[model samples]
Target: MSPMTIDSPVAGTAPATGPAPAVRLRGLTKSFGANRVVDPLDLDIAQNEFFSILGPSGCGKTTLMRMITGFETPTAGSIELDGRNVDGVATRQRDLNMLFQSYALFPHLSVYENVAFELRVRRTPKREIDDRVRAALELVRLSAFADRKPAALSGGQRQRVALARAVVGRPAVVLLDEPLGALDQKLRKEMQFELKRMQREVGITFIYVTHDQEEALTMSDRIAVMSEGRIQQIGTPTEIYDTPASRFVAGFIGSCNLIDGVADAATGRFTIPGVGEVPVDEIPDAAPGTPLTLAVRPERVRVLPDGARTEGGVHLPATLTQRVFLGDEWISHLALDSGIVLSASVPSGDAARALAATADGARVTVSWHPSDSRVIPTGELA
Candidate 1:
């Protein structure tokens, strides 16, 4: 409602330089009656960048995307497209296209006709429409199936046709809301790369929204993790996975073992209630006895034989409670004497075979490098 202004750069947003971003949000807010669906938010999606908004159901990801598309009016804040404010613009007038989970293809229309539908509605010249339709079909690798109807195509092919149609007009931005959700797992995985390739070839900005973490990680140039109608963190896949900004981000993005403890800056250690203190790389700038949470990825945890020699790492004794094989990798669940469970993932090979041979309830030692674990203030940004 107020004029959009940035007194300071929004956290995790790209620095304002070079060209204007494809999409920008300042103090964006949306609500239904007294309940807020999206909180005051600020974000910048760069031109031609593949950005994803990821969160669980009811986390406001869909609402946020709808606001950007002009379907839902924001209770506050402004939506900018290529640096132009479009707060009052109708959805059809915005320079963007959206693809939904449902292919939404006309059952009786041929693939070529589906891709040409938008251009036809715009009343483009016949020659231009033909060129664009062929190009769009070719881009999605559906040229050969141009004559096929949607009912005759595979789930993946129908999705491709939907994508071709969405991008046929060459809108500056394409918003995909879980477009691959209807496909089988294998097909969904395959489509992830296809979507990325299509975006790059078209050189169009893509704003993807999904609950699938792997989908976002594989296709997005950057990701915004959301929770409770607020953004938890924004960063590249590696940054979000390796150095999560909050406990929620750490646990939500991947399988992370979280341990609550108190920081002892003087000793450079974290003191767990039941388990003893463990070495930590750095301590937060908080007073002594401040609660902190240590986050360690399952792959980073090492399961060693009890009393095994460990150097320059935090080690604790535990019992091997369970081992689950996942083809390429094995997950070993170890329970500490304090009743805390930690999981270790090992590649399926000699080490994994050896771990599998270890009997359940056998004493084992779990160790991890201090550098591999991240410490954040407990309950901060959760």
Candidate 2:
């Protein structure tokens, strides 16, 4: 496919920003009657950034998007784009384009016409419209299929058409609400890179919305994890995954080992019940005998022989209960003396086979580095 030149943002309307964000929401909120679909929220997305809104169903991701797209007005707060306030602007006037999950392609129009529909509505000159549409099609690598109808193309192809339509207009930001939800697993994986590369080449800010945690992690430069009509945390995937600010974030984003224990302020350590006591990072605000929860990631937990010595953290006996072969890695469900299970992933063939043992009954010890664990206060702030 040939590389294409994308039109720059509208003159002065999409001003340059450094560390500053292209979009900002301050105390933004919306409601359908008494039901608060989207509670008061604050967020800032950097220029040319790939930011995703992720959460479980009914978590206000869609409502927030509606507010951003002008489909739904905020009941309170302010929204700004390119350092200008546009909280009450209409959808068409908001300098943004949304690619719907349904593709929403007009059956009567061919791919070329469907993509050029907006340009035609704006009364753009015929020659320029053709040039832009052709370039947009190439961005998604679907130039040859421009003459085909939505019904004539595969799900992935139709999605690219929808994406092409959105980018053809060169909106300030592209809003994708589960854009890849329609494609099959393999095709969806492929489209992830295609969409990301297209975003990079276009240099348009992307505000993506999805309920799939893995999808959000894979594509987003930064993510806002929402729940109960509010954003719980916002950070890069690595920061959110490695150092989740709250229990809700730690548990929701990925698999974690939660160990309940009590923190001793005087000695600055915690003793996990049915496990062992270990010194902890100094938590200045926590009182003595305060109960806490330790969140540990699977990769951070390792298995060892009965007498194997490691750096800090609790060590307890575990019985190999089940081993799952997951192509790239092997996930083992090990039952500990506390009746709680700890899962660890190793390479599929060699690394996993190195620890081969009797399933359901083999015994071993598990340990984690002291810094690998997080001592979260039981009473977390949301």
Candidate 3:
């Protein structure tokens, strides 16, 4: 097989960054009969980087993680960890640990024993085991619960125990598969920060898998967005959200209004069947009449006040069809006279109040700058 090259804008993969990556996968693929779950996947994760594999269900993220963990052998490809090919290495022998959604603690064991399980199993000195166990518990803010059993801890506390156990061995990487999935929304949000802090303090690579976009956005240094057995894009959260490379990414990372049309290279405009003669700058380098899609985030769009005019942006006559107040902001649903529908987010306070006061069915205009929107091939939308 030829040398694998990851062409995406992955951080720390350039020639100037020396030495081996924390984890590398080349042509990684998994197939079951007629179905290919992960197809020709290649990736490089840097040491101490919080990398996340984000995709919706059935997108093969877990299978890919299993391949790295040695729990599931790849049908074809190679996995290298810190410069060593680990394709045939035993799961337990790999220098990494995995934490699952269920916490998976030993119910019969005390919290101290649970955190110390791996060390005890390996027959470490009793004195060293006690010291490490106490330190790990303190690291996770669970030292007070050391004598308690799994049944005596809260969901979040149990998760901390799992994290402590995963890092107690000082492994090269920590594989977290939806470790926050079992917690309530408030607790889940709280644990996101906790996990990030833990990973930083431990100074180990983290390969997290989750379908939740917010979780990936909040905690990852770099994210690999996957879909249909392949990576759609890989970049920082801001890069993925602000300058998505494809329609799927534009729509998936957060809410965005995707307007399908064909570009007019000569006029620097796009023509949609419902919305006519939309002026969009920075059009992708394509010949006139090429199919294109305009992507603009909801927050970037604005509902122009009565008789308000835009200086250098596109505007269309629209009607306020629905409005929702979300405390922190307001969502205004609109329909254009030409049949296009879109949404705009108004911040709370005066602006939201004004939009909220506007009667439904009132005429309005929605406008956005060309720079605030992205143009991509129309066929990229999922």
Please name the candidate that would achieve the greatest TM-score relative to the true structure.
1
Q: Report the C-alpha lDDT of model 1 over 1-382, residue by residue, as the tens digit.
A: 0001111222343444568899999999999999998999999999999999999899998888889888899999999887778878777767787776554777878989878776776688999999989999999998899999989999999888888888888888888888889999999999999999999999999999999898999999999999989998999999999998888888888799999999888998888889999988988788888788999999999999998867798889999999999999999999999999999999999999899899999999999999999888667473
Question: What is the number of residue pairs that collide in model 3?
Answer: 0
**Whole-model lDDT for model 2 versus the true structure?**
0.80
The residue-level lDDT of candidate 3 at 31 comes to 93
Prediction-by-prediction clash tally: 0, 0, 0
Decreasing lDDT order of the candidates: 1, 3, 2
Candidate 1 is scored at a TM of 0.94
Instruction: Compose the digit string of candidate 3's lDDT tens values, residues 1-382.
Output: 0001111222343332467898999999999888999898889999999999888899898889889888899999999887677867777767777776455788999989988887876787899889888888988999999999999999999888888888887888888888899889999999999989988987999999998999999999999999978998999999988988888888889899998888877787788886688777768877777778899899999998755788897888899999988889999998988788899999998878888889999999888988888888766533
Better candidate by lDDT, 1 or 2? 1
Q: Which stretches of candidate 1 lie over 4 Å from their true place?
A: 1-18, 380-382
Give lDDT: candidate 3, residue 342: 95
The lDDT, on a scale of 0 to 1, for candidate 3 is: 0.84
Candidate 2 RMSD to the correct structure? 3.8
Cα lDDT of model 2 by residue, 1-382, tens digit = 1111123433446554555567899999888899988878888888899999988898888788878777778999998876767755566766778776455788888999989888887788999999999999999999999999889998889888888988898877888889888778999889989988999999999999988888889898999998879888899999999888777788889888877888777777778788667666755366677777888888777777665777665677888788787778777887878787888776756557766653557787777777888877665464
- Angstrom error of the Cα, residue 309, model 3: value is 0.8
What C-alpha lDDT, on a 0 to 100 scale, does residue 68 get in candidate 3?
Answer: 89
